[model samples]
Target: KLSPPLPLPPLPPKPIPKPRPLPPPSFLSAVHQGNNDWWRYLMAVGLIGSVFFVLTAALSTLALGLGWISLAPDGSVTIRDPLVSYLLSHLPFGFLGLGLWWAVVGLHHRPCRTLIRACGSLRWGRMAQGAAIWLALIISPLAVALLLNPGSLMPQVDWNQWLRLLGLAMVLTPMQIAVEELFFRGYLLQASGLLTQKPWILCLVNGILFMIVHLDNPETGYGLGWLALYYAGFGIFTTWITLRDQGLELALGMHAANNGFVILLVSYGDAVVETPALFSATSFDAAGVVLAFAVRALGFCALFFGIPGLRRDSVPPLQPQGSASEKPPGS
Candidate 1:
């Protein structure tokens, strides 16, 4: 009986397995497999640059407003012309900030081949999308003005005003758009993605930051509630294009063209900003502005989502987790 019990016990011996090691942390994985550090440095430089650039812009604008800088009797800041004034006043310092940051990033890091390739592949489509957005913005304001006051479109224009307006459209608008894109799409979005490894979080944060920057605009009566809604909507649409298209090309093109066209078509009166746009005499109250924003929102949805290539799935899928070394398709 004892021997039989011993045999039964020997049959029940179990095997022991060695424990497996855990995977590396995500931050270490990013450093090892991805170029996250490069993006982080780039973002740091951009943040510093933005602060300086904004301070410069504010001081300059204040100087101009306070008559420290010379102005014409018409309350217009005088430089070479409206176009030159806008460029000199607004463009250079901001661009310098962006340029410096880019230079630093380029020097320290390997180029982001994926982003560059994405930009190249979708260039033409972006152009078309941008043109459509610009057209909508241009037509909407004019249509509203015309509907409200039929004779608003036929406003008289002097030659100097035309040159100033043209400059506004050609130079200042693009400059403003570039500054915004460089900060939001190029710097903030890129940095957030690299840091968090989550695209949607980046989109949300960037959109909110963007709207916050517009808080001081006099047009919204400093109303944070209305301004937040307006900017959030605009940011969501722009961010959608950035994510869906896998780059900022479409957003950049659309923003540049929108600013250019708006400056060209909408006149707010004796404003020294360069643009060939003549403003309607009729005042747009809160309701009219809200309506304009609604139209813009609807139009953005139609232009971006309605297009075949601009759909969410149409863009290249984001790189799979733990596969940062894998080159994106078509990259």
Candidate 2:
């Protein structure tokens, strides 16, 4: 009996289940994926940087040859023909690089249709927005004059230089504006939006970076406080329009016209580059510049926010929400 009882003691073992695999990435998820292809982004930056350098070198060479821009014995690059120098220096690479990048990115990645649809595609609404922005530019300088110092509004320029500057401004303004819009509102804004899934954050970040780039302007003399505030404010206004309208048409139009007027109409003695028209005043008095900024701000607000037709139908689409591990490509 004891032997039989001892034989009855057999035990069973427990079984273990296998671990599950991680989910694939979604479109939005992939955008935030810590730049899995860091090399590509770096390459893009390098390519763009190289284009700028090459353009600068080419312009310098041309200037030296033409006697437009000269390196003096004292090491200053003086421009005998500023208008020609400006045109040669800026036009080739200013907007072209950005245009090329957009074309390449759009073709290669095939972004969502929602991203590419211009304000005009939304119908007549975009045109109104564009008009409003243009009006703001027209009114800005004048308003600044009225509010601050009317005398400062007048530009002083030699008649010949003014004509030359005006012509150059006409040629260069579009390119300058296009470069800004494509890079800030288009590329940087869109990319940031997709990554953060927050439209406001994207806009603000773009604006901040945009402002930072202007810090080195010889005109500003590296005055961090004034320049920073001025650019930040400018960026905020522009970003608001880009976000509110869901396209860059208004921003582009406004920027083009803004710089056009500045180059053609507003002139200052110490301006980094000479244009045809010069402001009567040699420098921006604090009150005068503030007034100018205010006018520009108000104009932007009125054109984009005041007008009924210009309002966008939808906020630009943000990156779809989800964990990176669970998302798919190009979502």
Candidate 3:
């Protein structure tokens, strides 16, 4: 009976699935991936900065020549229309973006996509998700405000003006937002990595520098200290997200959504980029602005990171090299 119960034929060998390839490391590796020469980095900066300044000066002159803007006798500038001025101001961003593209490819000798994401491609799905979530987070508060105090939002633009602003912003706002992300969080962040790999150190340095540049924004009139904190906080937030996600896709989407909402749906009296928004707020409570920013930052972090599926697949936090935060410059 035991002999008759001879063992059944051996089961067929199971197939082993091939492991998927990992995405290239965070953008922090970009500089190390290419020529990390200090001089080349400096030259790239000079090139883009020059392009921005020259375009700004030339545009201002042309605007004056065309009677679009005027210089007051007391060294003040008068804008013909806030919407026109805003659109014109965003023009330089386009040129600066091109210059940056050239510098990365020509000077750094790396694919320009290196500046976008390490895998050399934009994750459109990620960008869209980021935009949707960010837009929802911002619009929900305004929706509540509308429900509680409809009068708080005063109609500011007629149909025609609103349409014009929408068209221009649809084309230009994304460009402005993308260029800023490329320059600050993309180029500058990578350059800074050559010196130190500490995310906090990179965030602080970038945030301070970002705030310094934005000090010229009209919102500073609200309260220099509060606005400064707000800008620095935003800078820090964006940089942090960039570190977490390993690229600028999420940051780009969030920035575009924030700016688009401000420039299209609702605007404040002293917004830097004026828009023929559907509604306007004559005044903003400074303290409320800071508190709202804090709340929004926390909420964004929670929703972005708390959801298991939302996180980039198996991305690790960017860590300092050599077990220390600081390293010798160029090391």
Highest lDDT model number: 3
- State the local distance difference test value for candidate 3: 0.78
At residue 245, candidate 1 shows an lDDT of 57
Clashing pairs in model 3, backbone N/Cα/C closer than 3 A: none
Q: Mind giving the per-residue lDDT tens digits that candidate 2 earns over 1-331?
A: 3455456665776667777754322222323423325465556566666777776777678768877766879898777665775677567657355544644353334332223233113333454456456655565445654577555455465888787676666667666766766666755665565557565676578778887877765556524466566666667666666666556666766666556655666645545455655554444543345456666667666655666674343443333344400000000
Whole-structure CA lDDT of model 1: 0.54
Model 2 error, position 56 (Å): 2.0
Better by TM-score, candidate 3 or 1 = 3
Report the Cα RMSD per candidate.
12.8, 15.2, 6.5
lDDT of 3 by residue, 55-147 (tens): 888988898898988898999988868777777879989989988987888898888778778767888987887788878877788678778
lDDT of 1 by residue, 1-331 (tens): 4555444444655667778765323211222323456665666576666766777777768767765568678986555444445555555545555554554355334333223222223366765676677566657566765686675444546667767667554655656666676556655565565466565666678778888866655445524465466666567667666665566677777776655554555544333243344543334244444456567657675656666665654444433233300000000
Question: Model 2 off-target regions past 4 Å?
Answer: 1-38, 95-99, 102-150, 153-161, 286-291, 307-331
* Candidate 2 weakest ten by summed lDDT: 322-331
TM-scores for all candidates: the values are 0.65, 0.70, 0.89
Error of 2 at 196 (Å): 0.3
Q: Answer with 1 or 2, whichever has the higher TM-score.
A: 2
C-alpha lDDT (0 to 100) for residue 121 of candidate 3: 85
Candidate 1: worst-modelled 10 consecutive residues by lDDT: 322-331
